[model samples]
Target: MNLIKYTSIAAIFVSTSLIIAKILTYHFSHSIAILSSLVDSSLDLLTSLINCVAIFYAAKPKDEDHKFGHSAIEDIASFIQAMIIFISGILIIYQASMNIVNHKVITFEKVSMYTMLLSLFMTICLVLLQKYTISKTKSLVISADCLHYKTDVLMNIGIIASLFILKFTHFYAIDSIVAICIAVYIIYSAFELGKSAFNNLMGREISRQEQDEIIAIIQAENRIKGFHDFKTRRSGQMSFIQIHIEMKGDLTLFTAHEICEEIEQKITEKIPNCEIIIHKDPC
Candidate 1:
C-alpha cells in the first residue's frame, strides 16, 4: 500500500510540475504542439489522483457488500481515466483545427524546445519508476497510468520536433499539423485502454498459459484421479480459480482432503496472490 501511494505521489509531483512548465512555454511559443502536450500532462495529473484513490479502494478487505473483494475498483478507475484522455484528445484536435483554419502565425523561441526536453527527461524517469512499481504490485491503475505517460513521452518528442521545424521554416501550420496527428493517435489509444479495463470488469478469463499450467499441476498428482469443471477469472491483480478434483472411491474423506490441500498448495506456489477453491468427488 505504501508503495502504491508513494508511486502515485511521485507521479503527481512530476506531472504537476510539467503542466506548469508547459503552460509557461506555450504562453511564449503559442505553439499548438506544446499546448497539445500540455493538455496531456494535465490529464496525467488527474489520472494519478484517480489511481491513488483506486489503489486505496482495492486494498480494502472483503466485506458484506463486496464478498469477492475490492479489486475491480482499479478497472473502474482505469475506464474513467481513459475517458478523461479521450476528452483531452478531442479538445486538442479542436484547438489545432481552429488555429490552422485561422492562419495564425506561431512564433516560438528555443525556450519552448528546452521546456519539452525537460518534460521528456522527467517523463522518462517517472516511467522507469512506474516500471519498478508494476514489477512489485502488478497494479492495473499503475499500468494504465503508465500507458498514458508513455504517450506523453512520444507527444513531447513530436512537440520538440515541430518547434525545431517552425524555428527554421517559419511554417505556421507545422505546429497545428503535428498536434492534430498526436491527438488522433491519443484518441485511438484511449479506446483500446478502455476496452481492456472493460473486459476485466466483465470477468475475463485468465490467460491460456495459466489455465494449462493449472491443469498440469493437477495432473502431476497421481492420487488425483481426474479433474473437471475448472474455471478462472481475473480482477485487477488477483486471480480466482475453482476446480473439482476426482479421487478413488475407496479413499477416506481425510485422505481426499489432504490431496485437495496439496494440489491447492502447488497451484498457489505457481500463481501467487490468488484464491483457490477445490471440491473433491469420489470416482
Candidate 2:
C-alpha cells in the first residue's frame, strides 16, 4: 500500500511539473505540435490527480456497509480518466485540423525543443518508477497512470522531432500533420485503457494461467476427491477466488474443515494477497 501511495504522489508531481513546462513552451513556440504535447501533458496532470485520490480511497478497509472494500473505485477513476483522454484527443485533432486549413505560420526557438527534451527525460524516469511499482503492487490506478505517462513519452518525442524538422525545412504544414498523428495515437491509447478498466468493472475473471495454478493446487490435495464451481475475479490489487471441494461423506465435520483450511493455505501461498472461499461438499 505504501508503494502504491508513494508512486501515485510521485506521478502527480511529475505530471504537474510537465504541464507547467509545456504551457510555457507552447506559449512561445506557437506550434500546433507543441500544443499537442501541451494538451497531453495537461490531461496527464488531470489523470494523475484523479489517480492519487482513487489510490487513497481504494486503500480503505472494508466496512459493514461495503463488504467488498473500496478497491473498485480505482476502476471507476480509470474509466473517467479514459473518457477525459478520449475527449482531449478529439480536441487536439480539431485544433490541428484548423491549423492545417488556415495554413497558419508557426514559429519556435531552441527553448521549445529543450522543453520537450526535458519532458521526455522526466517522463522516462517516472515511467521506470511506475513500472517498478506496478510489478510490486499490481495496482490498477497506478497502472492506468503509467499508461498515461507512456503515451506522453511518445508525444514528447513526436513534438521534439516536429520542432527540429520545422526548424530545418520550415514546411509549416508538418506541424499540424504531426499533431494529428499524435492525436490519433492518443485516442488509440484511450481506447485501450478504457477497455481494460471496463473489463474489471464488469467483473472479468482472472487470467487463465492463474486459474490453472489454482486448479493444480487444489488437485495436489489427495484427501479431496474433486473440485468444482471455481470462480475468480479481480478488484484493484485484490483477487477473490471461490471454489467447492469434494471429500468423503463419512469424514467428521472438523476433519472436513481442517482439510479446507489446508487447501486455503496452499492457495494463499500460491497467490499472494488473494481472498479464497472454499465450500466443502460430500463426494
Candidate 3:
C-alpha cells in the first residue's frame, strides 16, 4: 500500500514535469503533434491527482454503512479518467484539423524532438516503477495509471517521428495527421479502460479460469457429495466467493465445520485476498 502511494506520487511529479516541458516544446515548435502530446500530459497530471485521492479513499476500512469497503471508489476514478481522456482526444482532433486547414508550419523541430526524447525517458522510468508496484500490490488504480503512462510513451515516440518527418520533408500537414492518429488511439484507449471499469462496477464475475480452479478444488474433497450456489465477484484487490457444499447427513456438525475449514484453507492458498463463505448442506 505504501508502495502504491509512492508510485502514484511519482506519477504526478513525472506528469507535471512533462507538461511543463511539452508546453515549452509546443510554444517553440507550433506543431500539432507536440500540442497533442502536451494535451495528453496535462490530462495525465489531472488523472494522477485523481488516482491519488481515489486510492487514499479506497484504502479505508469497511464501515457499517459501507460493508463492502470503499473499493468502488477506484472504479469511479477509472470512469472519470476515461471521460477526461475521451474529451482530450476530441479537443486534440479539433485542434489538429484546424492546423491542417491553416497549413501550419512547425519550427524548432530539433527542440521538440529533444523534449519528446526527455518525455519518453521519464515516462518509461515511471512505468517501470508502476509495474513493480502493481506486481507487489495488485492495485487496479495503479494499473490504470500505468496504462496511461504506457500510452504517453507511445505518443512521445509518435511526436518525435512526426518531427523527424517534418524536419526533412518540409511537409507541414504530417504534423496534423500524426496528431489525429494519436487522438484516435487515445479515444480507443479510453473506451477500453471505460469498459473494464464499467464491468467491475456492475459486479462482474471472476474469470472462467478462476471459476474452474475453484470448482476443481471443491471437487477434490472426497467427503463432500457435491456443491452448488457458487458465486464470485471482485472489488478492488478482494475477491468474494459464496458457495454451499453438500456433505454426508450422518456427520456431526463439528466434523462438517472442520471439513469446511479445510476446504476454505485450500482455496485461500490458491487465491490470496479472497473472502469465502462456505455453507454446508446435508445430503
Candidate 4:
C-alpha cells in the first residue's frame, strides 16, 4: 500500500495547513507560545517530504551501481531531517528571547485559543495514524517521522496551555517561558534523530536478541558441530549476518551442502528480509 509514502503525503498537507493557521493565529494574538509551535511545525513539511522520498528510494531494488539496494538513503534522509529540526528549534529560541527581552505582552482571544485547540486535535489524530503506519512498515524513516510527530503532539499541548494561561491569568511572561521550553524540547528531539541516523549509517550491530535467535536456529540443525565468528550489521530494515560453522571432516560433500542449505532456510524462516552467509570449516 506504500503506507509510509501515503502517510508522508498526508503529513505534509496537515503540517502545511496547520503551520499557516498557527502563523495567522500568532499574527493576531502575538503569542510566542503559538509562534514556537509554528516554528516546530514549519519543519514538518520538509521532514515529511524527506521521509516520503527516502523510503521510496530505499525500497528500490538492487541495481548495477548499487548492489546493496538503496536502503542507506533512509538514514541520510533522517540526518537531513534532524538538521532542519535543529535549525527550527534555534529559531524558536531566538524569537522567544526577543519577546522576553522586550517584555512583550501578549493577549489571546477566544479565536486564537480555539485555533490552537483545533491544531492539537488534528495533531493527535495524525500521531495515532503514524503509530499504526510504523507498526506495519517498521521503516526507519517512517519511525523517525512518527517519533517527531509524537513530540509535535506534546508541543501543541504546551502551546494550548500557554494560551489558556495568558487568556485567564494575564501573566504575559508565561507564554515566552512555555515557548522556550518547547524550543529546548525540539532541540532534544533533533539530537535523538541525529544520533539514531548516525548509528545506522555507521553500520550498528543488530540487537543481541536477534543475533541469539540466529545462533539458536543454526545450532538446532542436525550434524552442525558448532558455530563461531558470528557477526551482524544492520542498515535500515535489512540485517546482515555472517558466521562460520565447524562440521565433521569425514562428511560427504553432498551432505555438507545439504546441511548448509537447511541452516539457510531455517534462518530465513525465522527472520524475514535478512541476508545471511555461512562459511563451513571441516574439523
Candidate 5:
C-alpha cells in the first residue's frame, strides 16, 4: 500500500481502539469527563472510517471522470472530517453545560483515570506516527489525522487535570468549564482545517519558497531569456506546474526541445513527484 493508505489504516486502528477503550472506561466509572472523551473518540472513529474510504478513492488514477486526478478527494475528505469535529465540539459544549447546570459530580475511579491516561498515551503515539508519515509523504489527509490526535492530546490533558481538581476540591463546575474550553479549541481547529482544505480545493498557489526555487532554476539556464504565465496547483502528492519560457529566436526547434527537457529534469529533481510543462516562446 501507498503511504496514504498505510497511514490511514493505522489511524483507523488507533481510533477504533480508542473508541472501544473509552466505552469501557465510561461503563466502569460513568464519569462526565470520560463521557466527554468517549464523544470525541466516537467521532474520531467515524471520521477515520470515512478517511480510509476517501483515501482509497483519492488514490485512484485519473479517469475520464476525473481528468485532474482523484487527489482533490483528500481535501474533500479533510473538510468532512473537520465538519464532524465541529459537530462533536458543539455537542460536547452542550453536554458539558447541562452537566454543570445540573451540578452533576463526576466520579473518577482508578479504572477510569488509568484508562483515560492510557488512551492519551496511545493517542500521543499515533500522533507521532502520523507526523512522521506526513513529513515523508506530505499527505493532507494524514496530516489532518495527526491534527485530530494532537487536539485529543490537549483535551485528554485538560480532562485529566479537571478530574483531579474536581476530585480534590469537590468543585464539579471545573469539569464542565474544562470541557467547554476543549470544545472551543476543537471548533477553532476545525475552522482552520476546513479553511485550509477549502483553499486547496479552490486552487491555491504553491508556496512562495517553492515558486522562488522554480524561478531560480529556470533563470539559471542561459538559454532561457525569461519566463511568464507561470501556474501551479496540487492534488495529493502530485503537483502540476506550467510556465512560458522565452528563448532566443535563433534557437532551433530541436535545441528548444532539449532545453525544455533539461528544465523539466531540473524541476523534477528539485521537487519530487512534480509534473512540469513548458511553453516555449521565441524572444
Candidate 6:
C-alpha cells in the first residue's frame, strides 16, 4: 500500500482511540474542555473514513469512463472534509458560548488529566506519521491530512492548558474561552483547505518554478526552435503538461517523432509522476 493509504488507516485508528479516551474523561469530569476534545476527535474519525475511501478511488488507474483519471477525486474529498470541519467549528463555538453564558463550571478530575496526556501523546505520533507520508508522496490530500493532525496537536495542548488553569486558578471560564479559540482556529483552517481544493478543481495553474524549469528543458534541445501554448495542471500527485513545439519544416516525420519522444522522456525525468504531451508545429 502507498503512504497515503497507510496514513489514512493510522489516522482512523488514532482518532477512534482518542474519541474513546475523550468519552471516558468527559464521563468522569463533565468538563466542557474534555467534551470539546471529543467533538474534535469525532470529526477526525469522520474525515479519516472519507479519506480512506477517497484514497482508494484516487489510486485507481485511468479508465475509459474517466479519460482524464480519477486522481482529482482526492481534491473533492478534501473539500468535503473542509465543509465538515467548518460545521463542527460552528457547533463548537455555539456550545462554548452557551457554557460561558450559563456559568457552567468544569471540575477537573485526575482521569481527565490522564486522558489528556494520552491524547497529546497520540497526536504527536500522528503528526510524525503525517510528516513522513507527506515527504514520501508530496500529495496535497496527505498534506491537508497532516495539517489537520497538526491542528489537533495545538488544540490538545490548549485543552490541557485549560485543564491546568482550571485546576490551579479555579477559573472555569478559561475553559470555554479556550474552546472558543480552538473553534475559530479550526474554522480558519477549513476555509484555507477548502479554497485550495476548490482552486484545484477549477484548473489552477502549476507553480512558476515548475513552469520555468519545463520551458528551460525544452528550449535547451537543439532540435526544438521555440515553443508556445504551454500549459500545466495537477490531479492528486500527477502533473499534466501540454506544449506546442516549433521544429524545422525540412525534418522528416520520423525524426520529429523521435524528438518529441526524447522531450517527453526528459520532462518525465525532471518531474516524476508527470504526463507530457508534445504537439509539433513547423517553424
Clashing pairs in 5: none
Q: Pairing residues by index, what is the TM-score of model 3?
A: 0.93
Instruction: Please identify model 4 stretches exceeding 4 Å from their true place.
Output: 250-272
- Give the per-residue lDDT of model 5 (tens digit) for 1-283: 3876887788788878878887887887777677778877887887888888888987687789888778777778778878988988899899889997888876657777787788889899889888888888776677777877898998899888877886788887887788788788878988997888787788888788889999999999998989999999876556789999999999999999999999899898778767788999999
Please list the residue runs of candidate 1 whose C-alpha ends up more than 4 Å from where it truly belongs after superposition.
Answer: none
- lDDT (Cα, 0-100) at 100 in candidate 3: 82
lDDT of 1 by residue, 133-181 (tens): 8899775567777877887788789888888888888888999999999
Best by TM-score: 3
Per-residue lDDT for 4 in model 1? 72
List the RMSD of every prediction in angstroms: 2.0, 1.9, 1.7, 2.3, 2.1, 2.0
lDDT per residue, candidate 4, 1-283, as tens digits?
3787888888888898888898888778878787777777788878887777877787788999988888788788888888888888898889889988999988767767788788888888888888888778665566667778887787778777877788789889999899889989989989988897899899988877887888888878768888899988877667788999999999999999888888888887766668888898998
TM-score of each: 0.91, 0.92, 0.93, 0.89, 0.90, 0.91
Model 6 alpha-carbon miss at residue 112, Å: 1.8
Relative to the true structure, candidate 2 reaches a TM of: 0.92
Clashes of each: 0, 0, 0, 0, 0, 0
Q: List residue ranges in candidate 2 displaced over 4 A.
A: 252-255
lDDT of 6 by residue, 1-283 (tens): 4778988999999999999888987888988778878988998898889889988997788889997778788788878889988998999899999999999878879898899889999989998998887878776667777888888888888888888988899998998898888889879988998888887888887888888888888889998999989999887667889999999999999999999998888888778778888899999
* lDDT (C-alpha, whole model) for all candidates: 0.87, 0.85, 0.87, 0.82, 0.82, 0.86
lDDT of 2 by residue, 177-277 (tens): 99999999889988987897898889999889889988998888899999989999987667899999999999999999998888788877777768889
| 147-186 per-residue lDDT for model 3 (tens digits) | 7789878878887888888878888898899999999998
Worst 10 residues of 2 by lDDT: 139-148
